[model samples]
Target chain A: MEILMVVVVGVMFTIATYMVLTKSLLRVILGTVLYSHGAHLLILTMGGLGTGAAPLLSTEGPHSDPLPQALVLTAIVISFGVTAFLLVLAYRTYKQHKTDDLDQLRGSSDE
Target chain B: MSNLLILPIILPMLVGTILIFFAKNHSLQRVIAGITAVLLLILAFYLAHEVYYHPQQTMILELGNWSPPFGIVLVADMFATLMVILSSIVGMLCLFFAFKTIETERAKHYFYPFYFFLLTGVNGAFLTGDLFNLFVFFEVMLLSSYVLIVNGGTNYQLRESFKYVVINMIASAFFLVGLAYIYAVTGTLNMADLAEKVGVLEQQGVLNVIAIVFLFVFGAKGALFPLYFWLPNSYYGPPAAVSALFGGLLTKVGIYAIIRTFTLIFTHNTGFTHDIILALAGLTMFFGVLGAVSQFDFKRILSYHIISQVGYMVMGLGIYTQLALAGAIYYIAHHIIVKAALFLFAGATEKITGETSLYKMGGLLRSHPLLGWLFFISAMSLAGIPPLSGFFSKFALILSGIQEERYVIVVVSLLVGLLTLFSMMKIFMYAFWGEQKIPTEKVDKKETMGLLKPIIPLVILTIALGLSAEPIFQFSLGVADQIMDPSNYIDSVLNQD
Candidate 1:
């Protein structure tokens, strides 16, 4: 089960990285979102698959690692905020620049 | 008491919140902002003294008095205190420079809050012992920076700030994901606890993978090599004071994170992780200087040099020795002050000649003697000229590199230094020493307009730091020693009752 999860996450990360490297601004934003999801999954899988109960100690059985779960909760919130900000920035850039192909926005020397 | 740690975080935030209402009143905002900065500077100095004299101490604020793994803790160490002091120093100088430069009323109102929040994020990042909290502080800094970068809403600013915002947002997301994974594995958010937990995972490969993931996250923030493209452009959009502060403090915050993590948490895989860092440092220095050499704009050149200078600090980390890390810390201090001074000098030149591009200006030395001489001193110091703080830092770095028998990296560092000197001289010649040309409307009369005030204190600081290098180097060496031995930092937080 852990190996399957790792392979799935690895494939997702490659696709996400490829999307980010593209010239379209919107794709790049989506790519970032995808990449982050893959990374989160990879972190989870690396911790080793666990069974029994939730990390709460009140449960009498063996528990999952509560630390990674706590970390993931924070990570999810921060990433959500950043993604929302990036979406606004993307829309703003598109409205202003009138084109999303990053190549058109060349170095200063081009000016 | 631990509550003192909250003062640095809360005071600026409260003042920043209050200043937002009085945006229309520039003079009032200025007075209030000025006083707030002075207070912060004093507080930073006091904190520094406390950290220095009291080694066994830490101001660990337990959020809601929750114990250990459950709560967020802000831990103040020698490094965090030092960063706070330097940031306030930069903050005070930038605000003073802004007094004459910031003309727009809206800018005055919003600028102070963003500035304070930026510092808050910086101080918060330095102080936080929890990995997730570090990400939060980084977000706080980045969000404020986004607003500041596009503050004037210039067409150019809007265009550039968008890319800057997007790139940084992506980096922040990765940071979160990285934290999530680390937490999933370790089951604790506290940095000290994670350090203890990371060791229990005997699988070295998994550890190596996590360390590399962290490198990408911090690397994007620090502008290390391939991840550095966003920096030069975004930095160019903001006004001179904003640019200087960004140039000085923002990336250093990222580097500080890298130092904290690699030293405390990832020390187990030094051979794998540190080796990659060493190679990247060499490439970063080489390519960064090359980028500087090609840039024609005064500010653009300086922007590229920030990347190159960061390599020096990273080299210290890659070497992973006491003296080398000391040199890296010293170099960071020297570079921040000197780099900020150079950027301010660029602003001063733009004020006089009304030009940021080197092609339009000539023979500044003939009229603005102070500006020319000051720029020269900063340029020289940046190039690692002897007796200056820059030289001592580089001296220790290269010597330590050679001691470790990393001959290739040592040679590359020296060559980068020479190239750095060459590019700085290029700036000096094109902008200052060439033939003087009178402008269409008595530009010569306005040559000294608004030049002297900002550059004086900065120039004094550059030279003063050079003249009094011994004690400063000793302190840096002490910080370096502390970082090398993480037990000092780890024990303090963990042992706290």
Candidate 2:
């Protein structure tokens, strides 16, 4: 299960990297989103898969590690906020420069 | 008061959230931010004194009264408290300077709030004792900085800030990956607990990789060489006040994290890890100065210098001796004061002549002698001239390097110092010398003085730091001692009832 999860994480990271290296601003933002999701998955996988009940003393003979789930939840919230911010920023950049192509966004010649 | 540590983090968070409501009220925002900056400064000094003089030399605050190993914690050792003090100094000065210079339109867009929020992150990063908590604070700081960088939303700013945000976002992701790996190995996120557990763990090889992962994450932030390509250009996009705050405080936070982790958590394989640090420091210094040497614009030159000076501070860390770390600490104190003043002077001169390219500016020394002389003094200090803060810090770092027989870096440092002097003089000669550019009638003497006012304290601090280098270095030696032994930090956090 861990090996399969690791392979899945690697594939996700590969896709994210390809998207991030693309020229479009929106693509770059999505790439980062995908990248963060990969990290979150890696965290869960590294924490080890559990076949147990929820982490309540009364209900569980063996309990899942609550910490990685908690970490992923916090990370998801943060990534959500960051992704929203990135979208707004990309839109603003697109509006200001009239190009979402990262190459065309190079600084002015004299500056 | 053990609780005092949390106030520095909390006050800024509270004030920042409140300031968002009053962003359109310009004078009120200024007054509130000024008062808050002053209060934070006072709090910083008091806390520094308390932490410094306390026999334990480390203060631990576990949130909600949770036990340290299992719960969130804030740890302020001598090094951490000193960083808090430094950030407060830079933050306060920059806040006042921002009051004078930041456009009302920008202020109305929640500039003051984001500024305070950035401080909240910087202060929180300095004070936190949990690895994940550091990551969270890092995001807090970076989020505000993203807002600040593109606040005015110029095309240049948008382009640069996108790069900045994406790079930082990527770095933060890597930070999480490092956290996950370290936790997977040791089953702890509390830094003290990690330190204790790692000390006993036998897998030095895996731990070494985790340390490098952290170094990479922090290197991207700290402007370490090979990872510093984003800094000079991105920094050039912001207003001088924002740049001043960032140039002095932001990268240092990365270095601070590097110093904290390497000294405390990743200590078993010093030979493997610190050697990597030393090599990076050397490259960072050489390449950073080279970047500075090639830049001609006022802000651009100073922006590149930020990358270079960060190298020296890390050089102190790379050496990893008591004396070397003390020197690094002293170097940080000096660099923060001097670099902020230099960037403010860039703003002040830009205020006068309305030019950023050094070649187009001249004869400022004739019109504004005070600005010229003060800038010259700071420029000289930055170049490591005798009897200034810069010289002593470099001297101590080099002295320790020689004792350690790390001759190559010592030589590289000396060469970097020379290049630094050359570029500083390049700014002085091109910008302050030659023919008068702006007519005397167009210059607003009062406005210039207002801009220079906040910077005067920073200048005084750099000078004061120089003159008192002996006692300060002695004090920093104590800080270094506290840092070199992770046991002090681990014990304070974990043994508390």
**What DockQ does each listed candidate score?**
0.39, 0.85
Give the alpha carbon lDDT tens digit for every residue of B1-497 in model 2: 27999989999999999998897799999999999999999999999888878778888887998787777899989888899999999999998888888999999888999999999999999999999999999999999999999999888998999999999998988998998899899999999899989999943878889999999999999999899999988888888899999999999999999999999999888888898999999999899899889888999889889888999999998899999999999999999899999999998887778789987898888888899999999999999997999999999999999999999999999999999999999999988887887676686788778888999999888888889888998998998999999998988888854
| Cα RMSD of predicted structure 1 | 2.9
List per-prediction Cα lDDT, in the order shown. Answer: 0.82, 0.91
Task: Name the candidate that leads on TM-score.
Answer: 2
- The CAPRI class of candidate 2 is high
Off by over 4 Å in 2: none
TM-score of chain A of 2: 0.95
The pairs that clash in candidate 1 are A67-B187, A67-B188, A68-B183, A68-B184
Clashes of each: 4, 0
Cα lDDT, model 1, residue B259: 91
Q: Tens digits of per-residue lDDT for model 1 on B1-497? A: 36777777777888999888987788888899999999998988887777677747456678778766678888888878888888888888888888778876546538888888888888889889988889889988888888788877766776787678767766776776676567656667688888777766742776678788889989999989778888888888778889999999999999999999998889887888899999989988888999999988899999999999999999999999999998999898888898888888888787777788888788988877767988899999999998777899999999999999999999999999999999999999999988965352544544454545665777788778788989888988888878787777777777765
